[model samples]
Target: TLADAIFRHLDHGAAAGPSLAGRHALVTAGPTHEPIDPVRYLANRSSGRQGYAIAAALAARGARVTLVSGPVDLPPPPGIDVRRVETATQMLAACRAALPCDIAVCTAAVADWHVANPTDRKMKKAPGATAPVLTLAPNPDILAHLAAAGPARPALVVGFAAETHDLERYAAAKRVAKGCDWIVANDVRPETGIMGGAENEIVLISADGSERWPRLTKEAVAQRLAQRIAEYFSPDRSPA
Candidate 1:
């Protein structure tokens, strides 16, 4: 498949050299499932394609990649460690457990809130009764926590901002707010075909400025990001 071929190319260093050798990378992907009831939950349209591609790209570049993923239908990529998770809390814990990494990329669309008191039994509908109200509580901020991890923080921390408008403006602010080194901002509006589609058009926002990338397949985006990450850690390479 295209994904396999992309990884092979990177593995061989046909484009750029394997600059990530001897490094460790952590990636989070997919959408967290916030259960509303025993049989119902809230989730987004994340397909985990981009995050999976990134994990593959890093692994191909000889990085020891640990992917912490939420519930998704995609198969695990070869040559990397995978930790499956369900809710935002689990994802946060999984990410922290994979810490002391050189790089961290959080691509999971985590739910901001979860049912405060979810019951194990199935919630039944009562005849002539009104719907039940759910008490929501905010989930932990995984990206921020990692970024603020002090000495244990990764050298480079990347976060994703899936927005529908003000892409550049909002992403720039997110970079500062989250204390991440970079923000991969993309339009997730249905028409953009980015939420669950293969291709993506993104703006790479860093401390310096934002660079608009051309529309490309998720694999291409991953490869490009991996190369940039390699350059960031390359000796004699200046800070961006």
Candidate 2:
């Protein structure tokens, strides 16, 4: 298989350093669109840049990457298997299909709820007419599903928490609630321009404690994360 061939080449030619040569990584990125009607849907400001960068970085470290992405304008990263999805349910399914992976990173800004009964046609707004009521239901939690204890669960699971206030507290709580190994939390307040922006400021919360990272380009963050992942998997290194 092409994937096997690529890993074989990586394993043979890699320099003396941390290498994921034959590891598999599953990553989810972008914002899910929950349909309200045929023409309208709920979404957020995720550009998928950070997710894409992470996928690329992992691949650079010799991990075979499967990027499950939501609708976004960015081109697919080279040497990656990209699975495009439109809704949270679809994203979850895609993630499940890429199972038995070594690492799982849930970075997509999936909507928490979706319209339970979305109309097939475009909803029209008529003058002096009552607005149509949309029944709402919770979307499937992809991070929790991936982090759940099971034979198929990845060795490492990371979740992202984009928040407005009390970032660290909320992120720490989320890590436990979702059963993920780490939570990368960021302030998404409009003024911060972190969401849909080129740079990010994050606090990486894990059982060991929180590590505050200075604001840096998404690519830099991805590289740092990929390095950390490699270190975590290194045979000589102790578990964090």
User: Highest lDDT among the candidates is held by which one?
Assistant: 2
Q: Candidate 1: which stretches are off by over 4 Å?
A: 1-15, 238-240
lDDT of 1: 0.90
What are the RMSD figures for all models against the true structure? 3.5, 4.5
Worst 10-residue stretch by lDDT in candidate 1?
9-18
Q: Which has the greatest TM-score?
A: 1
Q: Residue-pair clashes per candidate, as listed?
A: 0, 0
**TM-scores, all models, native as reference:** 0.93, 0.92
lDDT of 1 by residue, 119-223 (tens): 888999999999898899999999999999589999999999999888888899999999999999999988887888989999998988889999999999999
Instruction: List candidate 2 segments past 4 Å from native.
Output: 1-16, 238-240
lDDT of 2 at 94: 94
Q: Indicate the worst ten consecutive residues by lDDT in candidate 2.
A: 9-18
Error of 2 at 216 (Å): 0.7
Clashing pairs in 1: none
Kindly list the per-residue Cα lDDT of model 2 for residues 11-80, writing each as its tens digit.
Answer: 6434335888899999999999999887899887799999999998888888999999999999999899
